[model samples]
Target: MSELKAKLFQDLSDAVVDMDEEKTVETSHRVIDEGIDAYEAIEKGLAHGMDRVGELFDQEEYFIPEVLICSDAMYAGVEVLKPHLKGDEQGEKKKVVIGVIEGDTHDIGKNLVKIMLETSGFDVFDLGRDIPPQQFVDKAKEVGAHIIGLSTLMTTTMDGMREVVRILEETNLREQFKVIVGGGPISQSFADKIGADGYAANAADAVRLARKLVS
Candidate 1:
């Protein structure tokens, strides 16, 4: 990369880590004006920044509020770069259907997974919170989604994730999509018991799991 291009990417990463929304937006616009490759800007710039945010989160150097702010800054840059993505880039993206299971209103984890999935090149169909089991199956079928991600933060609602797998099996659609579960109360053992294809303990792992599922 040229010195100027490298600096722009670094500036984009710094803006997200700093949670500077205005600078993020400005840098994104400059990237577009300079005809920088949007995909590279997103991956090498914004996603690079969020990767650090994840590390900070793992070390407890960053909390929920700080991560949320970083996400906001990252998204501001993404909005500017999205429209410029090449047709082939968009065409090659994988599809994911994600939602929080029924009887649970918690969605912070689900939202984080969605954002990370999108940043990692998955086209996510977010069903939001309190989604019924059939909705997940139906949406996955509708979109030809490769993965169905279910999340619940409560023990009571964790059973809802199992129900989703059961419904898909009964419909003979279980083989059509990979089922991945996550949240505060979920685990690999729980995922195996529930017949889910994979489990993610957090947002970054969710992305890796999604990629592995589709791969």
Candidate 2:
């Protein structure tokens, strides 16, 4: 039983990193038959793989295409195991509000961040792209999210991130939710200037920085 369980984990990890959709589904069933805990298989095996992929991305060893496919594999495995997840799982996960700030139509980065957060068991409320500053504050308040992830690909749109921070400050909610900033044109200096709680260069770094901020 232990050997089977271990193999199932290895297979699941391979599926995620390799982005093998069929293999991901196949390994999920093998996990059930092998008697491995479903959540363990997901959190430890699948999500862990994605996390590693994220790290590789941070190092530039893997690009967006690799990250995208790996995320797809992670989701495939999650879909198979979703039904087996505990009923109370919904309330146990952390809630996050994510969006691309105003004047930015670049969603690829935002979407990647959402996938990483969701795969890591965050309840992501994606507000999509070109969102106004007030919308971020309102959504965070409504969803009771502890983390607000802002994305922007254009330097011109980076002001939108600062505006979101400004709104949060004006609303007195700046201290309530941790803010993380990311995108192609954003830097650590930019995050510091905008009063953001954290800055990440890539999707993986975003998850790591977010965990640190919220934790």
Candidate 3:
């Protein structure tokens, strides 16, 4: 990367980490104006910042409110960059259907995962919070999605994730799409028991796992 492009990437990352939405948006526009690759801006800039935010959250250096604010900044940058993405940058993207499972209204993690996946070049179809298992199956079929990502912050709603896997199996679609699960109460062992293809501990891991599954 050139010195100017390097600086813009750094500025974009810092803007998000600082929770400066306006700066993030402005820098994103600068990225487009300078004819930088939108994909690079998103991966090296916004996603890089969100990765740090995740680390801070893990260390308790940042709490929920701070992470949420940082996410706002990151997403604002994404909005500005999305329209400028070139066709080659978007060609043949993998499709993913993501949602917070039924009886689970908490979606901060799910939203973060969606943003990161989109920025990382996945075709994300967000089914939103409190989605039924059948809805996930239906949407995945509709979109010809390669992966079905289920999330739940509650142990009570975790069963809903299993139901999605079960429904796919019964419909003989289990072989068609990979199923990945995540959230506060989810674990790899639980995922194995529930017959999910993978389990991600957080949003960043979710992106990595999705890539691995597809590749």
Off by over 4 Å in 3: 153-158
Give one digit per residue, the lDDT tens place, for model 1 in 124-181.
9999888888899999999999999998877988888989999998989889999999
TM-score for each model: 0.92, 0.90, 0.84
Alpha-carbon lDDT of model 3:
0.88
**Deviating ranges (above 4 Å) for candidate 2:** 103-105
Local accuracy by lDDT, each model: 0.89, 0.85, 0.88
Per-residue alpha-carbon lDDT of candidate 2 for residues 159-212, written as tens digits (9 for 90 to 100): 889998998888788889999998888999999998999998877778788778
- For residue 171, model 2's alpha carbon misses the true position, in angstroms, by 2.0
Whole-model lDDT, candidate 1? 0.89
Write one digit per residue (lDDT tens) for candidate 3, span 1-215: 99989999999999988999999999999999999998899989998888788788668898778888998999899999988887887668899999887544567788878866775668999989888899999999998999999988778888898899999999999999999999888999999999999999987789889999999
Measured by TM-score, how close is model 3 to the native structure? Answer: 0.84
Worst 10 residues of 3 by lDDT: 100-109
Q: Which residue pairs in candidate 3 have backbone atoms (N, alpha carbon, C) closer than 3 angstroms, thus clashing?
A: none
In model 2, the Cα lDDT at residue 17 comes to: 87
Tell how far residue 186 is off in model 2, in angstroms. 2.2
